[model samples]
Target: MPEPANALQRLHVHLNETRLLGSISSALYYDQNTVMPAAGAEWRGEQLALLASQIHARQSSARYAELVGEAEAELEAETKAELGPSVPTERRRNLQLVRLELERQRCLDPALVASLARAQSKGNALWQTARRHNDFPTFAPALAELIALRREQAGQLAAAEAVPRSPWEVLAQPFEPDISKTRLEELFSPLKATLPGLLEQVAAAPAQQGGLNEAAAELPEAEQESLCSELLNSWGYDPARCQRSRSAHPFSCTLGPQDFRITTRVVPGQPFSSFLATAHEWGHSLYEQGLPRSTDHYFPWPLGEATSMGVHESQSLFWECRVARGRAFAARWQPRFVAGAGGDPWGGVDGFWRALNPMRPGPTRVEADELSYGLHIVLRFELELALLEGGLPVADLPGEWNRRMVELLGLRPASDSEGCLQDIHWAEGLFGYFPSYALGHLISAQLAAAMQRQIGPIETHVAAGQERVVQQWLAAHVWPLGRAVNGEELVEQVTGERLSAAPFLSYLEAKVQQLLASAHH
Candidate 1:
């Protein structure tokens, strides 16, 4: 064991070094999604495999474990001596978080980690091809391999953790700490029961006249990209620290402490799609920017990391649904839409809002209407859970996906590309991640309700074209919290209750009523 005096220093060096390794891996992933050529896939797989092995070895090393233990023990002595505050709360947070992560990481087989990394890189490449060719068979083998590895990972973690958990539960903990499968089912069952009825109601509504709204204008892809940039700027995205680019799918990633990059695709004939993607991705960036940072060290220490993907997704959904899709926002930005869109295809703010808050469902999860978005997540979550449990075979995924879509959303995908292969989650071995998208919607609505209670209506600020007010409010309440709180804890802290679907269901009901009344008007 190292000396106590130097253990802290050694630990800091190790943590920073590991952080750099992870940053390099993140950059590689970002490039793989955005700019890496197709022919580079095999080498990229090898590169990521090497990095994953190195990262796993470093994180799970006995020496690093000793350093963390010694560092914690030293901090404990300070707490007994009434010097805890002097040590800084963030330091304690970092210690607590890193200890948990190391414990978890140490449970995994390093070779398994490397294998999963390589498989994911290869799977992503195959998935793109499969999606393009509408061929599920091309991707199923790699996806099956990834799923098998994830199940193995979950089993390893379950055996190592204090209380044993199921395979899916263990996998879910990384994305949503301490969230039980039972708890998720409890929260999700109501939405599952109600959403179908809601969909039925919307579908039966003669006023809605569902499906894609007529094009108000056909903005060129270049024009859409320009508008997306302007939109991100207006949302207070700091261009100095962020880069906007194109990708096969829209995503946001933090590559460094100061460098956050997000991607959005411009779709021809879809005037506001790119802008909405920008706002969604910008919301993600804002959360990253506002995370707790240590003045002492600058490697995105565990304490400063976003609490969970659920919490992170809530920030994005808040901007996408609660703010950007609201009436006031539509009114304030209607002119921008009309000007950029090249005509009043949407007629007015009401029209634009209707266009966004479409009642009909879609095959693509990313482009699904706000009302049906949770259903999309529900379909994926159930399938992933079943897949992990070996209840759903990979070969049968496309059939199950289409079946669930028709059952939940009143439509079936015409092909595998629009169905099972639509999302990048399964391809990346992210089995437990789908739930976070729906969790985010629930958290966003609950937080919005709480925000209304404290800071007044969100509409007033957004209508006044003062989105910074909302951003600052989030910065104060949730953004800087990082991993200091878990998903349920954060929801309870902000909303005076644990996770619930009530707020979200209520918000949807209100939206439907508003839309119906407008149609009548």
Candidate 2:
């Protein structure tokens, strides 16, 4: 056996190489989404497939297993030594991630990995085309294929674990990890039962909409981009170290420890949409930037990665929903926002605020109002769960989505573009990722409540344009920990409570009630 120090060195080298590959792949994906021309989709798909196969092969190889084993043995020995129990917990956590990933990949056949990768690559183009035409049929074949591939992938993973639960649960493992179907039902069931009534009450309440109101103004694209850059810079983003671009959907990706990229989309009628999306994506970038910089744990491993998508979503939602949407933030920045868009500052603030917090139901999840956002996710969760468990057929998705939208939101999408084809998740075979959005909202609310307790009124700070205070608070309590703690432990550590929907529901209810009350008088 290699010496403990030698084993640790080898494992570190291996992990770093994996991180580099993963980062490079992510950079490619970001570029593909933002700047890659439509003509290059075929080549990009091939490139992504090759990279995916390489990463899977490397991760599943015996050499990687040996390195992990050596590190694990050394850590075990060190824990029993005179060095006390203070040894870095990240080391053990890194090994656990490696083992879990290895097990997951081992369950998936290499051929299936390649096929899934290729399908996803091609599906992206199909989705783009379908979305452009607002026609689901154009994208249906590719989406069906993607779903079939994901179902197979789920089965393989489940069979490898020797557990035969629902396929959605298997698919969800990558995103939520230990979350079970029963637990999801517990968290969602009450909201599902209670939200409709609450939404009705909100709709019926005398509207109190007097926040940031602005007339829809045409801001040039270049001007909007410049404003986005300025906003990011003010938020401490270094252009030399990070990049932002436009895409159909907004997302953030990290290429390395220092290199991060985020994309935003421009809505013609709503300029704040792009600005707020930029803030949200920056939140994700900041979390990536906050990972522990210790020699032992860095990137692409459990120690350096985020706890879960839910936690990641929490960070983004924290900045976007909690900080950006706060009345204080608007009060302070209303001038700049109006000046940039070349509109009346006073009129723009109130209109923009109301537009930002509009309570109306919408068809697209990303574009949905905060109040109705979870319902969008809930719809997907139900459909995806059914698709994976064989309770719903791919052919029936369009009708099913329309039916549920009406039932939940009392509105129906006029077309599939606003309905089934709105999101890229299913087309890209992302079956189990939807729930994290809702979970992120829940986590954000809980964390915000805790922040309020510690900082004494975060909304006041936000309104005063003291965003740095909130950012610094998160950097200390939430961001620096990275994957050092699991989801449940992280929630408990920061909030002193188990994860619950009460904080989120309370937050939502309070905001809606206040908005409704103001609209009346």
Model 1 lDDT tens row, 1-521: 65335656778878888989998999999999999999999999999999999999999999889889988888889889998669877778788888888988999999899999999999999999999899999999999899889888887787666777888988988899887778888888888888877777877776754322565467777777777777787887787899988888899999888999999987665666788888889889999999877575345477678889999999999998888778888787778767765777776667667777777788888777777898998888888777988578889888888888888888999999888988888889987888999999999999999999988999998888788888888999997778878988998988888789999999998888887666656
Q: Against the hidden true structure, what lDDT does model 2 obtain?
A: 0.80
In terms of lDDT, the poorest run of 10 residues in model 2 is 205-214
**Best candidate, TM-score:** 1
Give all TM-scores, in the order shown: 0.96, 0.94
**Highest lDDT scorer:** 1
* Tens digits of per-residue lDDT for model 2, 258-370: 78889999887676778789888998888888877656676656777787888999998888888777766766666776677677633545545555677777777877677
In model 1, the clashing pairs are 216-345
